[model samples]
Target: MSGLKKVIIPEMPPLEREMIALRIANMLEEGSYVNLGIGIPTLVSNWIEGRDIILQAEIGMLKSGPLAEEGQEEQDRINASCQFICAMPGSSYFDIETSFAMIRGGRMNVAVLGALQVSAKGDLAGWNNPSRGLGKVGNIGGSMDLAVGARKVIVAMEHFTPGGEPKIMSECSYPLTAKACVDVIVTNYAVIDVTPDGLVLKEAIPGVTAEDIQKMTAAPLKVAADFKEMEL
Candidate 1:
């Protein structure tokens, strides 16, 4: 935890589709080679059009651009989710073997993934929803590999479940995709860091206090000394 000065906050809206994506996109560093997982994490490319980050798709894409404009996509250009996407000027494509090699070799700088549950200790469980019934689970795909392969893993999703339950907890009740792999968590309500001390609150959405988010999580929170409301 390095020193981060405070910033002015604007009014926050409910977590619409783009808000979550914006939060994640803002965390990217210049020249980072990042892989975005399916679901909400896929929306990140839409928000980072001008950034220098390289968007890597496990199905063999490099330097991919944002989602294609409706009806303006090339059928051959798609992402890991099989969704149409735009390619950057110097974008290139390869084979699945090459894609997984880059990931498994730890060449990716970051990975943004959606999660069903994330613990204060950084354990992730996005692959399955245990209560959904036997034989009904979400796809694991390459998330397990990307979680540990990337230099940093960031979980992006709604702050709570559809039933208004906290997604961040003291311990995950579902099957974990990876243990202690998440470095940061960006939710609609706040940005939290999984530090050795505990879940540390780094920033909060506007019009909300740090205490407001603490009550929503099952885990104990550590507010930074200079915690500020998020400007975005």
Candidate 2:
């Protein structure tokens, strides 16, 4: 046996965060071409290493790198959401039309996205809010193309809203970007794989019992007996 040290358990939320990232990372295949949506999806690019995958940012940058050093950000260098950063070698730049064409043309293999709600049928609701209060008007952007065009789609988000409303549901009430497109849902509480039979709980985060996850979820979740907490 190797002389590696045994690890200690971490406290809740941060551990949950890492487990969410890891669950998504484990799905990435070598040489796969992927487009990452904003927020948590953006963080996955930083975690991937020694993988032959190519990362495509929707804002016209290919082979996008992590945020650059304080003084290294160039005015013209930006990511999918217009965040400034340094570009990787062999990076390509183009207009949104061309970039979106790559997504819609079926050249990409996967798309990692963040969502507000995901239904049992694999419908996604993330681009807009249907409520009355004025909030940031969410745009569909390339989400429509990417969700439908990619061979696989992964959604990373917390399990529930601050008000404790479950994001995973029997049916999404908000407008959907795509129908039956999501392949996986990674949340702070568990890693779930989407199936025709509803969400499959593949891994429950440590300290968060399986019963705890099921109780918090809006839809009936099927748990795998071999479930384990995801490792980053």
Candidate 3:
């Protein structure tokens, strides 16, 4: 929507879903208490084995581990995605009320979530896509609380929709999950930081330039001084 002209990017290989999860995992610090939202964010646990980071599930589990192997799933041990997960030693289980109390009380260090659109000012819109006609019926779940309560919020999502529309925009066209709550965005094509100055392009996939990413994003992107190729 800005005057920046769109440029066609040469077809480039994007990061695989696992790689995206790894990239986000690499950004976490030791001793972090993290909440992974459904979708790609749920994969982060698989890459964090042996790390000091602890995973939390809104469905009343803490110290959650990676996804369960085939035929290893237990009916009661699941993450927010409804996928069976392994539980770490000292894992704790409680009711949803206690789980949300931890989230709302701001005890989480980070929350990795999926998003539909993120604005230049770090606004997140993930709960509903109006085009689906779900309207108020769409599930909001714990996204709102996590976005607001986490010390940092990182969005892990694809850079574009199936129709090839950019998910990073000057303003969100969908209903917002929270305002200016996103801190970082890791996509298949690039890693960006949402800052007071603007969106900063941090790391991009090999062969893609900041200019190429800018053409795809609706908002302006400021290239970080340390910009470099994203590595898993």
Candidate 4:
């Protein structure tokens, strides 16, 4: 998909996902066991490549890595997205049972996932958008398991859809993946924390005002007392 043309979205900056990816990666503490969902969350592996953070995949790989180059792809050693990857030192493998067990057993410290719509109450709906003809037969993979199983569920996605629709809403319009599962949301414009008081704006990118974010968002946002510009 390199050099791919994006004709539908022309308003947003091109490197938005990259910046958001790094921001989410930096939030992880050392030695945190993380399950990175597909899409933007997958890029986090590139950010934490050398650190001690362990990456887990529901497709039976652990201590995973970024996508392999064209000639290096190995079918047997692919990640959940079936993309070939290089295994890091001390990486391990298991059957599907134990793979999901790690997720369902609460062994994962963090689950970084992509989202479609996330409510202020932290309700998640990453799968199945009826408007897009996506939810019918089997898209719910390990997202639900990771959502409720992880100690912290951090969603990494664009702040809004390609058509300028807010993905962060007062309530999710899509089918529920998990209720109050998202703890943090990292987007192109701001970093938000889902709290008992609702979504709090933790940080905003430089030059992007809170009013800009509020206009793009569908729900009310609580500005954090320590709100500041994002370092990245």
Candidate 5:
């Protein structure tokens, strides 16, 4: 948070939450076993209806569908966020033990999760937001296991905090969810890869330049050779 100035690019309007989720959904490969965390990640289910991807919920649900319509809600059919969801055909249910086992056992291929902060080295600080209180512990839920156990972790979140602070930092100020666990970050304005070298900028929204993104990012960003406008 040091030496970072608060700034906003009015010319480059950030993508809407739905568009962010849609961009993430398009990146998932076919036949992948994916988990959608709460918040923006939960909206991904709505865009993958006809895809071959299989969605898993930590609460013992498999092949979970999009959020249920107003009149189609089922009390027992809910995602990890506790939002009612539609169950796709051939959906299966299991006990909590089995559900966690699948996660900790490394059965999940990709996990789309929200983040409070991500370090340049790919450290993820998502579980506890310091604003809650000095020592209050936020519900960690299954993020720890998913961060380490999943083959790939993709964080979907806004580029900056509501107060215009950069969420991607040189070092996370909040408690870490996992160290060096993030693979990709899909923010509203850019798509970044957390590589061994550093955070690489792969894509950005039209009209936004590398210097523009650099102004908002606390960590140094390496623009990929093939950088291009995001395909929103």
Candidate 6:
């Protein structure tokens, strides 16, 4: 807060959700091997339409296709992540052992995941939001493993809950994916980077100012001097 100054929200023509996806897509690198988790993570692959990147799914496949065709989803050849997919030519399948081996062996460059809560300290909480269910809990799947194993862990999520609760906080109140594993967080409201000092507001969505974003977040955040709303 001390390093930030109040500024007007820039104008953005598109919806914040689309803006978030566009912003997250900018983080991808050529030739990087990546895994996209469900929800927002899935949308990222679609955003990277022409990028020459290799996609991996946790279920045990490499170079998976964007999304499955509308009526051509094959039950047998689906990626290990199981989001309903087709494989790219030359895409190969392996057993779960090899699949998890890629994740645990640090062969992955990045992993984009969806989170229910992420702390300012970079701890992730996507698997257990008690409010969403009773005795049964959310699935961690390979999220914990990927977050720890991958070189970069990017958390993609909407800025707030339907009830207007902030997803980024000073500390997570739910089950953790990993401590200090998240490198960045892309949300409908803002694009933030998790640093040792605090959450840095790198880009805010149009119609939302730095002050507005700070008010919405549970944790205190820092805004860059040249901060501006992301442009698609």
Identify the candidate with maximal lDDT. Answer: 3
Q: How many backbone clashes does candidate 3 have?
A: 0
lDDT of 4 by residue, 1-232 (tens): 1121222333435347888899988899998999999899988887887788989989898888777888988788988877888877688989999998999899999999999899989999888777666556548888999999999999999877775577888888888889999999999888999999999998887777777677777789988989998886
Where is the poorest 10-residue window by lDDT in model 6?
Answer: 1-10
- For all candidates in order, the CA lDDT equals 0.85, 0.79, 0.91, 0.85, 0.90, 0.80
Candidate 1: clashing residue pairs, number: 0
Location of the lowest summed lDDT over 10 successive residues in candidate 1: 1-10
Which regions of candidate 3 deviate over 4 angstroms? 1-7
Of candidates 4 and 2, the better by lDDT = 4
What is the Cα-based TM-score of model 1?
0.89
Residue 7 CA error for candidate 4 (Å)?
20
Q: Give candidate 2's whole-model lDDT.
A: 0.79
Sequence-dependent TM-score of model 2:
0.86
Arrange candidates, best TM-score first: 5, 3, 4, 1, 6, 2
> Candidate 1 lDDT (Cα, whole model)?
0.85
Prediction 4 global C-alpha lDDT: 0.85
Per-candidate RMSD vs. true structure?
A: 6.3, 8.2, 2.2, 5.2, 1.5, 4.7
Candidate 5 lDDT over residue span 129-162, tens digit each: 8777856577899999999888999999999998
Per-residue lDDT tens digits of candidate 2, residues 13-111?
634555566668778998888888888887787668667778887878787777878888788888767778777777888988888888988888999
Give per-model TM-scores: 0.89, 0.86, 0.94, 0.91, 0.95, 0.88
lDDT of 1 by residue, 82-168 (tens): 988888789999999999899989999999999999998999999988776655567789999998788999899888787667888
What TM value does model 3 have? 0.94
Which scores greater on TM-score, model 5 or model 6? 5
lDDT of 4 at 195: 93
Off by over 4 Å in 1: 1-13, 70-72, 135-138
On the 0 to 100 scale, the lDDT of residue 209 in model 6 is 83
